[model samples]
Target: MSVPENQQEAKNKKKRKFEMPDTYVILFIVLLIAVAATYIVPAGTFERELVDEVERVVPNTYAQTDSNPTGFMDIFLALQEGMVQSGGLIFLVLFAGGAFEVVERSGAIKGGILRAVNKTKGKEFLLIALVSILFALGGAVGAVANSIIPFVAIGVIIARALKLDAIVAVAITFGATFAGFNVGFLNPYTVGIAQSIADVPLFSGMGLRVIAFVVIVGVTILYTWSYAKKVLADPSRSLIGVLDEGKEGESPLDAPFTGRHKLILSFVGLCLAFFVYATIEFQWTIDHMAAFFIIIGIGAGIIAGMDYNKLTLTFLEGCKNLVYGALIIGVARAILIVMENALILDTFVQALSVPLEGLTPVFAALGMFVANGALNFLVPSGSGQAMIVMPILTPLSDMIGVTRQVAVQAYQFGDGFTNSIFPTSGPLMASLAVAGVPWIKWAKWMLPLLLMWTVIAVIMLTIGVLINWGPI
Candidate 1:
């Protein structure tokens, strides 16, 4: 090991080819790390008490128990639980993707989008505003988690057509949804669930949340439009610029809009409207939404003049295309299952609250924001995290003299914003995959915007506490 030889070896290492790992590989590593954590991290539990017929963790009931290490076999058991737990979400992704494929194949979406793009040619910000508002409202009221999955591909294509980058497309679509969900004025999954746990009136404390939503949505629009203008000015500067084919120069519509296209587009719009209405008003589960999509696909196929054979095959093709995204959702769930089987999920939640107990009211509220943000990695589901953390968080907020509404709002803010950035988030991953953007590239591009959102979130949380945001 001469010094010259060591230097030569280092040079050789530097020349080694850098290959970005597959998304599945990264998730698999996370699964193994979680399994390792089960052994390394102490086992603990919290007493479960039923409140309002829903099981919840009793605050201050945490206790370290004898280690019941998750064996290798337990990993298999965890996988099974993950599949069972994520079965509904996985199914929704596949089915909805298939339905959207049918709609896309009909050419209605293309025609309508092309016409819309033509109208907004010079004023691209108007297009961004319109789309952002729609998606944000979708996130705010519809709890549209998997609902956005099917549209990511179309959004990317539209972004390209509009001379924008993949990041702008994501911001306009998922990013807007993330903003609305982050504010969560009427989001049933995060806000509704947390409010229920806190014993606050459902959808109460809307006054401040509405303001937060508008501010966030406005910022999202400005940020996205600014990026869009940059990319439009120089296509090579786009985050996905290397992958961009300069599709902006291509005509979005291969042909003119027809009567059939108009009818099909109208049908698709009505279906979307029904989806939002059904979700907000009737509390439609993912399964119900999937069924609705299935019906839409079949009906649209018929309207578009596709024969029975072609329709079935198109639907199947759509499902096949999304198989990777759907499986990732289930695989991501495996990480949570391992934690659950090892009984470390509660330990993770309980341990976070230790420091918050000592902080002042405002800082404690802020601490809650940080805690929920960190926990979002472990449990990405809004409703699931609300169920897991809110029970304990609600009582802790009360103990520290922070309003329960503030606690719920913190949870909402924490859970929603990270979805667009976290790799472990299935929907985020699925959307990236659908848009053909690499995780590393997307994360790098989104980091600055995420930091901006973080600052805004802090201000929003402080305002909530200062104003005593509540229906307590």
Candidate 2:
């Protein structure tokens, strides 16, 4: 059965076509690599001392420990362990999904976005800027990454109304959030944690950080707006082309912006405000957040006139939609689990910090920034990374003539900016999942912005070193 020439050529082309790996596959590959590294990378540890009931790594005390290579059975065990460890965050994502679904069903989000779209028809830039700043401020104030998931739908509706794409939707919301988070002027998670460990005044280095925030956020807004205009002019240019084919008729514009919609949205706004206040004031954890989201769903459902059964079913359906995204958080955590079980995690930190000792102060500061960014891949938690690395880097900073403030700033820039692009970042994966944007698609679009931010970070750190930025 000899194939025709054209058909044979077509078959060859099909065989050669590249297909991006699924998110789970990519994560599993990372896990496999981590498991392999357990044997290859030497196991090591640092002495820790308790300060204010927190464990921090002791500097200049790196000890090579016995290798604890992960076995094949441990590979499967790590998955369960990772899920158990990340149970709180996973539940938070599911609750948020269910809550946002109830709100969407009530027409509140759609109605409000439509009204805003109509009002800003001629001035789209104002809408973009306003949304970016609000989310950026939320990020600046220590909002967790998963907190942005619930609001992505609102951004999507506003973006669609203005003929923009999903990338723009993510840009104005998630992108802006990370921009402020990376600058971290008042970010309690990264800045607060790092400063506390470094013995610098909490939230002390604000002047330069404020400038970085404005510049980074401004650049994000302009970059997003420019891409949006292009997508508007030519639909073919969209990164996620043919936006939401099945959802094209799902726009609730025909539904009038009723009193119930207003009431529902107002309650949502109040809930968000109170959520922020409680998070900062009461130091609420993800469990409290999960419970609060359930309240939001039930309240919104009742207000929307849904009976108990309908509400329950709607909530479950919403949870179902997010199952793929939610589980990914746990799977991504497995990578860290593998590293921890293998005891190679601290070795990475020690290796990264050693090179900085030999560089000039300015370059050393920049190297710290670069090192933190790399460490973020394995240890994604900002506060956790601070607890591990700050103890070592703080004293190293002093020895090398870099200010503690500058070291914390480097940690902030390193830890925050890479979250958007890293496949291991569960919140970023979840955000893209909710928006129906693939990881590869978002990465391709987000890399340029990250590069720009990197350059900005370099300039900022250089200036910090030059000025001896400190309150020491």
Candidate 3:
């Protein structure tokens, strides 16, 4: 029997009203689970020693410890503690947003993008490839994930001009940066730190890494291009549909490219060059980057002829816009705090590594990749994860007949690729927040590419094991 028209319409409306949880809700649920794991997962510790001023865990030193489950009140306290711990990073996101907003308000970014779009009118693929390669090179050099956040704005503007969605913008910027970071040809954070921990000469296995960089980056370009093509063929196919609707001919792209815009953009370029130099030469951290961004914002404001009041307000407005994304970084860090407080993080590392002991050399290498990928959720920072996991894995690689270099490679694969998908990843969440793309939409679109990259990683690792790629 068919329902009445009114009743049927109501039922259909209810069925179509499914809602995905907000980013904060998803993170809070994960936090609750982490707190629960403290009770279920046994607490353990590994012997750690200071190695070149960096603390590293020692293998075969796992010992069961009394559980320290987080109390109800501590759960709430973790949020404040997380913010305190990650203050530098959180502020960096805010500063970057404010800086970029200052520049965008000056019309430099939009003007430059308009010029590029016109020049590459029919050859948008060329533009995509070039931008992808440059960002990938940035990632390859330093594992600069969070540092790439400011550039997401430029990427979005470009995507909009090309009639693409925010996902494509993120894919070309964050996704491509992560691809090179995962391969890590000369990445000081992941590859350099892991190699140092494993006693492999820094960058000793460059040949294979360089090859992996090319293949992975090639795959990224093709995947992003394919998606862009689909979007062009049918706008509805876009993962994040119609970023700017009802604002036709009202975009920044329609504004005139004035001489002042060129001057402002030139200042931005100089600031970036100095930032890279300082980072490599002086080991600048997020705090330094944050300060640098503040300078950039003020400097750009002065160059744009904005009065003091307008500039300060613009900077504050920019910060206001990114508060949601900036806060996500702190909340995400709280997940780690819960595990650390419970003392289950070491237990998790021990559990993950134990099963790889009995596997064959190639399989052990593959297992390391998978294990590190899983561990990334617990420890998302590349250098931080290296300090924690490499000491254990480095020694295990010898017993399992896997080279230390290959072990390092596995760590790079595990830590780098998964950062793009993990909610625990501050940079990934911040980039999405900057671009206005929802996490669920990004995950649904990126999962396929991630799976393909996983296959490529497995193949590369297998080859590394077979040829015994190493300098150990």
Better of 2 and 3 by lDDT: 3
Which lDDT values do the candidates have, in the order given? 0.74, 0.78, 0.79
* lDDT (10s digit) by residue, model 1, range 1-472: 4579889999999999985466567667778998999999988887877756545567678898876677888787777777787676566656766777887788775566556656675677898787778678768864345557666765776676676777777777787888888887755446765776576766667778888889888988888888788887888788777235554457543556789988987787788667656655675655676677789889889999999999999999988976875676566677777877787876776676677777777899888888888878866767656655675677577556678889998888788888879887888888887777789998887787788888888898788788777663
Candidate 2, position 437, lDDT: 88
Q: Whole-model lDDT, candidate 3?
A: 0.79
Please report how far candidate 3 places residue 394 from its true position, in Å. 12
Best by TM-score: 1
| Best by the lDDT measure | 3
- Note each model's CA RMSD in angstroms: 6.8, 7.0, 7.4
Task: Give a tens-digit lDDT track for model 3, residues 174-201.
Answer: 9989999998776554676577658776
TM-scores, each model vs. reference? 0.66, 0.66, 0.64
**How well is each residue in 1-472 modelled by candidate 2, as lDDT tens digits?**
8999999999899899575566577678878998999999999887877755545567788899899999999999999987897676567667777887787778775566556556666688988887788678767755434567767876777777777778887888888888889887755446755776576665667789989999999999988888888887898999887455337567543446889999887787688668756755676655676788899899999999999999999898777866776677677667777887788877876776677677889999988899899978866666556655675677567556788889999999999999989877777877888788888999898888999999999999999999989752
TM-score ranking of the models:
1, 2, 3
TM-score: model 3 vs. ground truth = 0.64
